[model samples]
Target: MAIGVAAGVSVGTVISPYAGAALADDAAGPSYLLVGGTGSSNIGVLRESGGRLIPVGQPVPTDTGTLSITVTPNGRFAYVAHTVSGTLQGFRVGDDGTLERLEGAHLAPGRPIVGAVVSPDGKWLFATVGSVTNDVQTYAIAPSGALTHVDSVTIPGATSGLSIPVVSPDGRFLFAPSFIGATMDSYAIGFDGRLTPTGSQVPTGDRPALPSVTPNGKFLYITNEGTDDVSGYRIAPDGALNPIGRFPTKAIPHGMAITPDGRYLYLPQTGGQSVNGFEIRDDGALVPVPGAEAPSAPGHLPGRVVLSPDAQRLYVIDTLTTTGTAKVFTYRVKPNGGLEATAELPVDTGVTFSDGATGVFASLGPA
Candidate 1:
């Protein structure tokens, strides 16, 4: 399974199906960073390079309350939702990048799943029973990774919380975000991975929370966290959404990280502890990446933000740190997109940052 290899350590080998494209930084292969939240029932795993992030081997339990993590574009497998144990676990990517608990695979959608994603062709694994079941479930990803449910879709006007849907790097379209019901829901990804409501919902600006999509799937961004700003859209070849407006940010913004040729875009701002940056205008407007903002460290709060599938580096995820501990900063992705802090991985003392929680989750395993 060659996913982030480490077991006996000897990366001096060969196994390329693009070898999962080396999970992220691939200086020949070795990439990982998984963290888990609500204080950790164990998931941590680190081990990237250039931008640092070390720790790999130890924390890997999972079964208390993780809230989000879904790596499987061939990085073996990783599921892990668990909104207070509503369950989802599954893991099995141990070349050396550790993590092995996948016994019966786990599953459990009884309620409160909170977030999970995986369809760029790793079969399917969507999941987000969001706040008390606003719906969006679908499973089916067996080839040993387990998980079979396959269908649920009910997000029409869900006025409460939790959101983690985004899946359109050509996997068709999924884009969910309905947190507090500001709206932003578009689907149409079925060939078996059921979910088809390209009815497009739209509206968003007051609490929309998270949803990022670019890398050529056109544009989609949406981080409204109760209106600090960032809503822009334009993915309509059928997957609906066409707004392209509200873009202010730096008050709450939550998480987002795009760049792999889709221009820039970073935004972290858990109540503005900072980490802005943008620049993706072809029509889906959003300018302001000149120096890339970035601020957190004083009181520390930045929620989730990733990039480093060779986009250089730029990972934030500070649910708390300033001593309370749960850090994972790292930057250096400047070719004009700015941001150069570089290095800061602490995590494991009760990871805190809430509201659509997503503590951290990079990939590229196989070294």
Candidate 2:
């Protein structure tokens, strides 16, 4: 059956495949989604009806490229990383999942910021910032969706670029991979949103970049963009990382998303224009999924791959082209871990910026 999602319309129970167990939610049809785009304009929000993304309200403007977006667990607010400008922007999520601009809700933590992620508890926001600043910034989230800067901490022994930051599903640790440093940095997130390093750094293959924690919170994975591989680690109780092993990939793997059940890991290789799948073992090792290589068109530059709330669909955000014809490619995850392309939704990004590409995620919630 084709997956149809609605946002802010009604609440229903959904048994998500990603969570292994039956995760109860009020609704199966989630309403709103937001995608950040680069160009002269700001990012836009999309209303989900019948599983498709349609523009809503007005496009909220931000400086340069809105590289990444993070929404609160309750779906009340969204925060975006304006990478080019080294800043953060906020929006109040409407009841129907619409986005309303939040004025005076910007955070300037210095230049060359990369990723922004809100804590699972929805109390804190964390982001990676300036290559020279060499720090991760944390902020306290206000009830109105505005952010109040709290603290910043540098990755241990970090001497290069920082890609993005990921908080463990347990919200106990924040993982930031230093691109050139070849080190996986860990920080213990305090109850009040402050940060403290885990004392030691976990080494990686090459440019140990993007880090994603499994939904089960048992393991951590980092993509080595410089070495064309990925590394897995065992998460210690004290938020330390112990290297499991390294796995090869198609090419230049950047972004990764795991299934809700914690059974699979999906990596989107921007340079390869293909997604590689791996079956996660019970012990935190990665095994390649047979016949799970999903490819896209040549210039798609598919970077970010995300699964819908129901885990029935995976959306690949193909960064914009020079002529403004980029698209968001949708696929249906087969029963056997393979992917079948379903739809290529057109997006108007106007122009492409080489700095970085942004992505959109379709939301599911009650109307």
Candidate 3:
């Protein structure tokens, strides 16, 4: 009975942090999934083992169509964003990594809350709202896992609306890119988890949709849908940006993920129906891996890429355009930066996938 789950919540096996760590130490714990999309329901839940994902139960309902989801650092909670209604939902992460919606967890940060990201310390959650309003809401996380609204910052220059707010791995800076402006706005996270605009925004390629920072906090990469390339930046010590270079990629690339080792970058090209792999050089140059592209069915456009904590395995979710249907694929990371799709056929996820990732799976007891 984790806090805020309300009475008679049937989600089974919520484990303690210590027990979860023990399961993770043994490498037997299964990973969990929280996907957001335009479906009959707003969100979906699933579990993963041996590089395959299957629904854990029925899809979890949300206030509207869903956008993206981010888990807290301790693997204890998850926060999901809605595509409409300007609301965000919170959940308790079961010990088995199952999600139990928390009562009174519906929060209206602003109208049309579109993007959400959890601080690496698990102490804060940030969300962007109202492209017209340019509002970014901040919430403090209590020990009981409740969210207390903190402060809101407005970006007057974000006329096109804000993309996702990506926190630096070391938790020092937050980057918010505007899709229409070709700009990446930055903020310095204060000691109290408040955000102050650092004003280090650099111009990206064009129509930058998704931006991801390296796990080492050294560089940032953004997908340019309009430019058909990926933009790279060298992160300054104080969280400023120095233009590294722009690397050509597949068309309409939407998702950007880096391996845990910080040595490789993976971009799922929406137009090509394949994933392009790159070896991350120290100078932030993306050198293509020989035969790094893994082609899939044409309609199955890849959305998200999640890496195993050890960086040995990668999971990709592919979804069709019109229907609420998707397929999840697993790939083995070869030592040479090549992605070898596991022999397993794509599993019919049976739901549109808008949001998901890989982190701490679950902490099971003495499995």
Pick the lDDT winner: 1
How would you encode candidate 1's per-residue C-alpha lDDT over 183-300 as one tens digit per residue? 7788899899898888648788887777888888988888887779988888888889888788887788877888888888887888779888888978979998777887887877
Candidate 1 vs 2: which has more lDDT? 1
Candidate 3 lDDT over residue span 298-358, tens digit each: 5677877767655677767774544347767778889888988788776655566454221
Candidate 1: 10-residue stretch with minimal lDDT = 1-10
Candidate 3, residue 296: the lDDT equals 67
Write one digit per residue (lDDT tens) for candidate 2, span 60-175.
Answer: 55565555678888776777776556667677665544555666567665476677888988899887776633578888887777778899877666374655778999899998
Better of 1 and 3 by TM-score: 3
Ranked by lDDT, top first: 1, 3, 2
Instruction: Sort the predicted structures by TM-score, highest score first.
Output: 3, 2, 1
RMSD of each: 17.2, 8.6, 5.5
- Native-referenced Cα lDDT, model 2: 0.69
Error of 1 at 346 (Å): 18
Best by TM-score: 3
Candidate 3 Cα deviation (angstroms), residue 321: 5.1
